[model samples]
Target: MAKEFTSLGLRLHADAPHISYVFIKHHKPKEGEAEVPNALYVAGLPLGLDEVSLEAVFSVFGHVANVVLHPSKRSAAVVYESKEDVSQALQHASSGQVVDFPLPAPEGPVGLKAWVASHRAQRPGNAELQKQLDGWMEAHEAAEAAREAARQAAMAEDGWTVVVRSKGRKRAREVGGMSTVSGGIAPAAAAAARAAADAKQAKQAENFYRFQQRDRRRSELMDLRHKFEEGRKRLAALKAARHFRPN
Candidate 1:
């Protein structure tokens, strides 16, 4: 459950001389909202007469919600819906005259708002409360500082290094067996080395296959040209023979 700070105050009527503080039994009935259909029972009345006696006393106002009783334990609680009903019940139930049984005092003051204001005046304000809070905060901070100091002292006593490890690339290279004087590999130089190797390999493999393809195509063209020239010579000879013959 979440914790909360609610202020509860007690007020006494200045004129009521007989009572100092009303003794609400350490075990008293809890007052619930009026709509709930349950009432508490007063304990230790004679078994058969108990319910009849309570109903007779409480039903005078409105309705008796419920009643609880334990004769051996000698305690009881009665519940009613209306404040008017409860007021009427209390009128008859208190002292030995009605039920001849003891009952607890009413829970809250007769004038609740005035009682609350009186309590607020008597209590501390936010500034004084804050001062107390600040004192606690300072004490907590001092305790934390002491703990940190003790931790550091323990580390020193055990020969631990307090300095943080450096995250710089140059420092990492020096730690990893590389020289720091030259400031590591230059970007341009690394790019040039990779490019030169790629260019040399590309040039060697490219033209060797292209030269073989070109030579094969040239030989096939020459053979086709020779065959076409021979065909032209045979046609010319045929035309000459036909002209020379009787025509």
Candidate 2:
């Protein structure tokens, strides 16, 4: 830790009251991340403020990748395109201040009681979250490999190369927005539904053609019956008169 200094009008944690300033260690790049100094964590944002507008103002300093707001923690994290971008942003800030972020949607230059942290401190439990994600990805890849191997074995003894997934195509989705294998309907159920739909359409087409053919035959029989009725009426009239003429 450097000289015990206090940040003026900045708070790292929301739970701690009465302590307006915090003594944070010098920023070291987060472990396991890329060598590029690409992220900046901002603290002391107001509740309910959106990340989009926060990013919009910070964009003036550098090309921003994403801005994630932690409403529960009352902090936000901004990722830049490159390490140089981070340095440029720090230069834009006032002397001794890490982040010069203005309060989101302020009338004048009057800003919030905010401070920026390293990528690590900006988010709590990020390490554990990353570990879980990595484990999930590994399991997903292993399962896919097993399926491919089984498919190859099923292919009759004729030598055939197993085709792998195409590049750039995503394999599995995470649990947030889309309903994945955990929360979504099973694959077997989906396949059965598709088969049922196909069968119903086929049945409908068969009935439609059958009805059309029946209608044609019925019309032919109706025309013959109508002609017979007319001939019978003519014969009756001729017999009643006791004479028959071409008229």
Candidate 3:
């Protein structure tokens, strides 16, 4: 087989590895497997063609449903309302057909000057903005003052000593050997006081109801025993006083 292939000038060298050829038949379309209707792939479109202009040109033949333009490829895919509209467009529309149509009006600012004017019209003046910022700062400061006053009143009511920190970044000297006291009690001391109060309250409540129940039970048992003893003595006296006894 290698020599026969070499004689035919097919194989470059004799005694080469056997080569296998596998043939695949062309794919045939099944029944009713036609391309979709009412859509057409249109080529040779003008470079400047936009979706709106393309639609306008195609709409003259029939009602165009949609027009998608590919500017780089200079082509468009147009879908019409019906297959008949696509057929009509293909029959009539050729090069230079439907050349004159009304162009759409410009939707936005056309030039750099118009854009700059629009932008300036939308922005607020510097003086107006500064005044607004000053008003906002004044309001914010007033709100802070009111909050601080309310906080001080609340701290005083709660028996917390208010210790004001030194102003202007000076290190304030500690009073009464306290390491740090900014607004009220130091966080560590406050936490210890709260924990001690909570423990005392829990100790007072622990087993309180159970003690009452035990005391009430003891009192009831004592009363029952005293009643039984008194009844026994009275019955003994009645038995001793009996005049006649049945055998």
* CA lDDT, every model vs. true structure: 0.51, 0.58, 0.60
Model 1: ten consecutive residues of lowest lDDT: 1-10
Candidate 2 lDDT over residue span 114-199, tens digit each:
33334435666878889989999999999998996576565523544333343343345432232222234566777899999999
- The local distance difference test score of model 3 is 0.60
- The prediction achieving the highest lDDT against the true structure is 3
Best of the two (1, 3) by lDDT: 3
The C-alpha RMSD of each candidate to the native structure, in angstroms, is 21.0, 23.1, 22.0
Ordered list by TM-score, greatest first:
3, 2, 1
Q: Write the residue-wise lDDT of candidate 1 on 5-78 in tens digits.
A: 11111122333333222111112334763443243333333222344455554455567666655565344455
Model 2 Cα displacement at 113 (Å)?
Answer: 18
Q: lDDT tens digits, residues 12-70, model 3?
A: 11443432121111112358876557876665443344788768766776888888676
Q: State model 2's lDDT.
A: 0.58
Lowest-lDDT window of 10 residues in candidate 3?
4-13
Q: List the candidates ranked by lDDT, beginning with the highest.
A: 3, 2, 1
What TM-scores do the predictions have? 0.25, 0.28, 0.31
